[model samples]
Target: QFCVNYKNGGISYRSARDGFGFELDWTEFYTTTRKPSAGEVGALPVSGGVINGNLGIGTPNILGGSSIVLGDNDTGLKQNGDGLLDIYANGVQVFRFQNDTLESKKSINVTGRLTPTDYGNFDSRYVQDIRLGSLQYGQVWNGPGFSDTSGYVITGIINGNSDELIDGAHRRPIQKLIGNQWYNVVSI
Candidate 1:
């Protein structure tokens, strides 16, 4: 037998044979105008919503496996046994994380600045050419000047002395003439 009673601002249901009961709280339900808070236990908003807690999908034990899984169930982010995060695409592991290193199965294209915390090096066997907008020489070139009209070369001074071409510390100012006006290349 089954019974449903309206009480305590909610609908309480009970199964007589199983001796099990549950309550559907009215406060948990919300309309279009009423939205739940970030930490609230309620249905997510149709448009968008913020969750303040950890969300688990596909698995009840979120700590064991991937926290999220796409509709295909193959593409998702998972932490491996080594505690490194791995990114999967179409059931294939495309990217992975090692100790202080990021590994990718394909080529990486960066549009903006790629700054390294310390020193960075590239394999000469794989890297054929590297293009740069401007090249700055640490030491002054005492060799013959190139007559290449394709590129522009500007001569500058360090510490207001043209003879002191090299400034290891880069504490001096570097200036170049631009249409009769001198502009400081590096701010002091």
Candidate 2:
């Protein structure tokens, strides 16, 4: 069982298992409004598995600075400010999405490819020995306790020469993923 009481008003509570329950006394229901002053104490009870103190003011998205920053700094995710979702595959950026409204039901889908031509070091290689392919998205490909998605593979090899390098050519599916709707999954 759980209960909440307002000094000037009444009390309310709810039990576990059945559903939700609440009650208010006349004084508590339509009680006189008594706003809290600067140092006044206001108490509200929240119940779940454990009970904790009330959430104080300035208790929103708060964070410090970072050592590195990826994507556009003007619109990158902020720690103390806002946050954006960034996705990467094999040390490469894939997509990024921002959560501006703080909505409960929100999701972003990213689709892109990594190619050898994209990297700077591969240009010197006399012989291109790298190949880039689509990474299959299996049901369990992402997150824990999931299976692998086939069709995704990275290919390339370095020649014997000290300067020889491997290049994996990749092609971004521009037609399929060209729009503001497609999130920028770049990360630091």
Candidate 3:
């Protein structure tokens, strides 16, 4: 007969099979491996030990954090396999690593002013947008003013198919800023 004294956090336990009996309380849960004092939580310290599979925090529900960190200024943290690490502040993803390389998948979307002291590098998918009064580089890509129905589209010529120059009226698709690389722009 296993009786639980839930009022005072105690348990009355007995084995019905062999007439053998033993009482196990919440703290007694770890008494077999290590004796824990009254009102103390159990902790296991295993250094240089191997964890086989995925380790999870708040597996199903959301795990909250204030001042969360993955790799700090000091010695960094290491994650080997393809596991996702999400860092959230105020319930928003400030930094995330999902893909293979950390540098490739890592992204920072902060609100306030961010000033980097050292030189920073970005992926090749980034382009500079220069602006002058009513006109700007990459601004013409807006096609017609964006609404819920239509927006700008970037494309490259394929085989000898449909014309690639914004419906092919003004064939001047390539625009060069002085000696820089040509920018394929769509006209208004």
Candidate 4:
């Protein structure tokens, strides 16, 4: 068991693998064989914030199941071909990272408190539409858009009518409303 000194003087229960990028207070960590049952394994806030439990940063599998594990071919967090971050809490995703960046530029190096509604969730087809929700949780991108123009690039609302345009553009909705809440998600 690895320990993290979370912001707000809060300590975290996770693994040493989660401590890769950030510094950790080794003394506060609770030594145990039990892996993190939820959230990123080592993505604690800087020094004084609460650890918002998310499945994206450290741990991959859902909690509660004894056999939860990182999927096959997975090397690190968000390394899956799905190409999106999965933020799960206690086995359920409370949020996700949907990148609208083009395949040529995959990482989101944006500044400030960026919200999912800011980007179109990696689908260039909807990039031009400012009126649409930028990103929704739970969705994933297979890869960059296909090389062929005949193959369409998708964004929010994978299988639905365009909200603003009168002409129906037939494409998959990259975003979907889960439990009536809009989240920038990449469906795997």
Question: Considering every candidate listed, which one attains the maximal TM-score?
Answer: 1
Residue-by-residue lDDT tens digits, candidate 4, 1-188? 54444444445553344446764444443345433433345544455445333342245544422222344222223322365554333443444455763332233466888657544445443333222343323222332423323323334334235455332222433344543344443434
Better of 2 and 3 by lDDT: 3
lDDT of 2 by residue, 7-63 (tens): 645444433333344443332222246444433333433343322422222332122
Give per-residue CA lDDT, model 1, range 51-149, as digits (tens).
555454563333335445555556677777676888777667788888878899878999999987644253322433322234443333553333433
Worst 10 residues of 3 by lDDT: 131-140
Q: Between which residue pairs do clashes occur in model 1?
A: none
Off by over 4 Å in 1: 1-67, 120-188
The candidates, ranked best first by TM-score, are 1, 3, 4, 2
TM-score for all models, in order of appearance:
0.34, 0.14, 0.22, 0.16
Model 3 lDDT per residue over 67-132, tens place: 223232222222333476655443444444666533433455789998755333542234444322
Query: How high is the CA lDDT of each candidate model?
Result: 0.51, 0.34, 0.38, 0.39
Quick one: best lDDT, which candidate? 1
Cα deviation of 160, candidate 4, in Å = 64
Q: What is the model-wide C-alpha lDDT for candidate 3?
A: 0.38
